[model samples]
Target: MRERDIVGREGRFIAEGKVVLNVLLANPAFALESLLVLENRLAGLTGQIKLCPADVPVYCVARDVMDTIAGFPMHRGILAVGRRNDRRSSEELILAMPDKALAVVLCGISNHDNMGSIFRNAAAFEADAVLIDETSCDPLYRKAIRVSVGAALKVPFAREGSIEAIVTRLQSAGFEMFALTPSGMTSIHDAKPARRTALLLGTEGEGLPKSLLENLQTFKIPMSANFDSLNVATASGIALSRFSRFSGF
Candidate 1:
């Protein structure tokens, strides 16, 4: 696809909709397919793109410029901003799932790469859902979806507010809430999740907030001496592997 189909083209041409600055940068292949959702005609694009088959929002910018407004840059190129994706509700997501299924509950994680990795790991492990707290980065944001290698586009996800409410709902639905932290005495190997589990991973720098820590079940990934912790993405990958069991034990 041409660059205009990816992000906005130039002046006089608006973005397809209210897409964030980054997601457009993430997936350059997103474009009008049917009604709402976007379709990727080109393969091997970084993931950061999404669309619905029902939304009718559209606009046109006449041309593309290698550098239009900011006359100078490290690289010159045209850009297109995609439409904003609709966020699903937690109830809708739960109802959409089968019983005793697994989903990833991303806590206050902020880094785009970590968000992307979490989605990739979710897809890799066959988790049922990927839920993000209100404060977390938008997984649909171009870089995240791109970094997630389009796993963000493939996985069923919901962006919600109030981590407490979402967690409570998950708990009520019988999800085992395991908070991934370095401080926990029980390692992931010992904690061992079941068929129905909610892996709650925290942020990049400060880790889980004290408020969330107070309520959820917490644990750490046991590492070699002197090594404090792994990058949030790496740790999630390692933790995800442990969920692998003998003949689906």
Candidate 2:
């Protein structure tokens, strides 16, 4: 299928590769609309194909045909169409969180790679959910899903409202909001997270809005004097790892 055929399908997305296809099939949060495989690679995918529901259709095509259809070489030789089973609002997602929770909140994160990596880290740290503002790119974007190694399919997230509004809602829900930045007042190692904690991150370069840092409790990862900041994704991993239940903090 062409790029236009897969993207902007309205609640639908294209997932590629065996790993991502497996994630799509296994997760009940997303429904598989259809699967496409390279004919030569079909034998190796029997186990995954069996995992699909009886109603889901699977199509196998020759390599040349597949390449022509995709408008590029199908190196991984796997692709599937998936749709979110439920699109929850930010309020609904927040209300559903357990009392003691760790969440990653993002603002204006337009880079797909960074978005994907953040989700992967969130999953690794066992975060409860990810809250993103409207300006951020879709976590379900094809490259984001692939870069996340399917973690995007596993993490629960909702995109809505302005960054300030999102932070306010989480704050009202008993979350201790921390705007992560280079000039934070408290060191990440020293700050004690509350029962419900949210780590706020912003796009690279500009970082979190100055107004947010002024209002919320802020924390920073200590670094060498020569370096001032970490990439948004890297910073998230460090912060989430510190606050995650597994950290024994």
Candidate 3:
């Protein structure tokens, strides 16, 4: 396949899990930066956009059909195949996090905007990496990136496939998993944010699935008596703000 048009190199695609695979890269810069950020293999590479792998100039000829194929606009201009990060045991992520860190866990959230807003809030509230359940929308998706102004790129993340696995992992690592529910048992105002806590927020439409609901320590964002629930992203901002200042580390 002929390399795609010469969309000028936009630096690199720097993220974890989404790299590391021996992906048939159409653009070498995006592929290389994606893997090098892992620190596992960070040697013998200049951090510039020079085409060192001279045999394969960074080119992908799919731009003409990309929009029709992906069902969305291609903002990043380049595409590649990369494996999603392995579901890290919740404990592994928790232990790696700082003491009393405020982290947001995206559970069953599909709207790219909602996903981006969650991360933007996490960064705004000084929260640590945003944790996403295995079923959540990718924060690195193109629209998500645009919506987040690349804040999704700025924050760190640990992705998990199962709600139970993440809860068990976080619990084992000494982090509380507060499941946000409209009909939850405790209100956010009365709830205390732990120095090390993970908020498990559900999607806006269906709320938490019964399986996840049964597993989480639920919390409600107290609202005007008549208001049923806040939009998932907005509620996250409010909840995150409560914990932001005390995280003074």
State TM-scores per candidate. 0.68, 0.96, 0.65
All candidates: CA RMSD in angstroms?
Answer: 7.9, 1.3, 8.9
lDDT tens readout by residue for model 1, 1-249: 333344333211112222322333344334333222122211212232334324523222222322233233303122333443434588678667777677788877888778988888887877778888888877765457657766765677887877788888888888888888888758787776766778888886788788888877888888887866789988878777776332254
Among the numbered candidates, top TM-score falls to: 2
Please report how far candidate 2 places residue 48 from its true position, in Å. Answer: 1.6
lDDT of candidate 2 over 197-231, digit per residue (tens): 99999988888888778898888899987965688
Per-residue lDDT of candidate 3, residues 143-232 (tens digit): 565566546655667666676777776777778878888888998777877757788788898887887788677888877777566889
Q: Using TM-score, rank the candidates from best to worst.
A: 2, 1, 3
Candidates in order have lDDT scores of 0.62, 0.89, 0.61
Clashes of 2: 0
For candidate 2, what is the lDDT? 0.89
- Candidate 3: list runs displaced more than 4 Å: 1-91, 225-228, 246-249
Index of the highest-lDDT prediction: 2
Least well predicted 10-residue stretch by lDDT in candidate 3: 1-10
